[model samples]
Target: MTTQTDLIQYLLRLGDSALIQGQRLCQWCGRAPALEEELALMNVGLDLVGQARNWLDYAAELLDDGRDADHLAFRRDERAYRNLLLVEQPNGDYAVTMLKQFFYDAWHLEVLQGLSRSSDERIAGIAAKAVKEATYHLRRSGEWVERLGDGTEESHQRMLDAIPLLWRFTIELISGDDSETRLHAAGLVPDAAQIASAWQARVEQVFTRATLPLPAAPSYFYLDARRGLHSEHLGTLLAEMQFLPRAYPDATW
Candidate 1:
C-alpha cells in the first residue's frame, strides 16, 4: 500500500479505538462506584473523545472524500471500523472496567509516546498533545488496578475473574499488521516490538503491585478488528451511537 493509505488506516485505528472506548467509559456516568470516580471517568472519556476527534479529523483530511470527522465517526458501518478488539468489548463490573482501562491505557501511552516523535509533523503534534492525556489515564487506571487487586478478597477475585475474560484479546494490542509495518518503515510510527515490550513491562509492573498474576499470552481470536472484524457488541454500540445522525441526517448542531 502507499504511505498515504497506510497512514490513513493507522489514524482510523487510533481514532476508532478512542471513540469506542470513550463511549464505553461514558456508559459509567451514573453507574460508577462513587461520585468522584464518576466525574473522573467522564473526564477521561471526554479526553479520549477529544483525542479521537484529532485523529479522525486528520484521517478525514487525508482521505478528502467529502467526509468530515463527524461523518467518518458516525456514518461508518461496523465493518468499516478499525478499532482494537480490546476496546470494543463490553465493560462488565468495576473491576472489569478498570482492568480493561488499564490494559488499553498501557498500550495507548506507549503508542502515543512513540508517535510523539514521528517524522510526520502532523502526527507528532497530535501525539504530543494526546500523550499527556494518556499518561494520566495510565496512572489512574494502574492505581485502580492496584487498589482493587490488593483490596478485599471479593474485589481481588473480581479482578482475577476479569483476567481471563480480557487477556486473550491483548494479543492484538502488540501485534502489528502490514499497514503498521509500512508506517514504521516510513518513520511515521514507532517500532511495534518496542511498543509491545514497553506495554508488557507496564502491565507487569501494575499487576505485580496489584498482586494479580499475569496470564500467558493467548493466540489471536478468529476475528480481528484491525481488519474490520469485530465482536457482535460493536453493532449494538453503533446502533445507539449512530441513531441521532442516521435519524436526522440534515439536522445541524
Candidate 2:
C-alpha cells in the first residue's frame, strides 16, 4: 500500500526538481549566449517554477500539514530536498545547461505522460497539464542539443565535452527509489524501468542526429539511493534562493 507519506515524498521530489532547475535557469539572466536565447531560458525557467508550485501545492495537501508550496520551496533543510543530482549541477556553460535541460526535459515528458494517467485526480490533473509543458521543454532543449553538437568546431567540441560529464546524472533520473516503487505498484506513479527505456531511445535518437558520441555504461556516481543525498552544489543554491524567504518570513507583496 502506498501511504500518504510516500505520496507526499514523491510529490516533494517532483517539486524540488523543478524548483532547483528553475533557479539554475534563472541564473542565466542577462547571461545567456544571445538575447533570444536569454529570453528563451528565462521563459522556460519560469515555466518550471510554475510547475513546481503545482506539484508542491498538492504535496502540501497530502502532507496534511500547515506548510504551503512556498514553505516547501524555501524552508526545507538541504537534506530534506529530493531533487536529482543532475538538476542541481552547476550551469557551467551554455552547452552544459542545454544538455542538462535536454536530458531532464526528455525524461520529464515521459514521466508526466505516465502521471497523467494516475489514479489520483489531483496528481492526474497536474500531470496532464505538465505533460504539455514538458513536451515543449524537451523540444526546445533537444533543438539546442542538435544545434550545439552540429554547429561550429568550437561549439561542437564543447558539447562533446559536456556529454561525458552530464551522462552520469542521467542514470539517476530514470531510476527511482522505494517511495517511487511503492507508488508505482499502487498505480500512483510510472514504471521507472519502462520509462528508462523510452528515455534512452529518445536521448539516443537526438544524439544520433546530432552526430555526437553517445555516453556508455552504468554510472557509479549516480548513487543508488538519492532520497537523502545530494551534491555539494545544492546547499549553495538553496542559500541564495531561500535567502529572501528565510531572512524575511513575513514579507509579502
Candidate 3:
C-alpha cells in the first residue's frame, strides 16, 4: 500500500477476512444440507485459507517482525483483528450463509479487480491469483441465493428474513475510512465509494435474478469495522482459534 503501516493493516484486513470466512465455512462441513454442498463449502474454505496464508505471509515480511502467518492468525486477540464485520458475523441458516457469502464474494471480486491493476507488483500478483477463486465463489453463492430465494416457500422466506440483518454490515465494506482514502489516492486500493457502485450493481443484478427485493436505503448503524472494531462474536471466535497457539507457544504441526 502507501506505507508500511498502511500495507500491513490492509493485508491484515484482507487476510483476516479470508481466515475468518474460511473457518466459518468449515463449520458447515458436517452440517450442510447436502453432501455436495458439504464438499463445496469445505473446498471453498480451503481456498480462503490459502489466500489468507499468501496475504499474511507477505504482511509478516513487511513487518520484519518475528511473527509469521500462524502467529498473526492465532496469537492475536480479537481486538487486534481487522477483518470486515460481514465476514465475522455468525452464519445462521443455509440461506443466511449463502447470502452473506454472495455479498462478500461480490465485494471480494471488486477489490481484487482493482488490486490486480495496482502499481505494487506483489499485491497485483496476489490479486490476480485471487480473482479466479473469488469468481468461483461469487458464482457459487450467487446461484445459491437465486435458487433459495426463488425455490420453495420456506427457502424464499429464509432468504428474505436473512437479508436485512446482514445488509447493514455490507455498508462498511464499501465505506472505507481515512486510511483507505490515503491508500486509494496512492493507487494502493480502489475507492470504496466507486467500488460501492460496482458492488451495488452486481448485488442488484443478483437480487433481481433471485426475485429478492433490494433495500431502498439501508442504514449503516454498525461499528466501524475497518479499524479493528468488531462485534462480540469475534471474542468467542478468537478464544477458540487462538487457544492452541496461546496454550502451546511456538508449537508446530
Candidate of highest TM-score: 1
- Across 180-243, the per-residue lDDT of candidate 1 in tens digits comes to 8888988999999899989999999999999999898778669988779999999999999999
Each model's TM-score, in the order given? Answer: 0.99, 0.96, 0.96
What's the candidate order when arranged by decreasing lDDT?
A: 1, 3, 2
TM-score of candidate 1 to 2 decimals: 0.99
Model 1 bad stretches (over 4 Å)? none
Q: Over 4 Å off in model 3, which ranges?
A: none
Model 2: worst 10 consecutive residues (lDDT sum): 217-226
TM-score of structure candidate 3: 0.96
Largest lDDT belongs to which candidate?
A: 1
lDDT score for residue 252 of model 2: 100
Error of 3 at 25 (Å): 0.3
lDDT of 2 at 184: 89
Q: Model 3 scores what on Cα lDDT? A: 0.89
| Candidate 2: C-alpha lDDT | 0.88
Cα-based lDDT for every prediction: 0.94, 0.88, 0.89
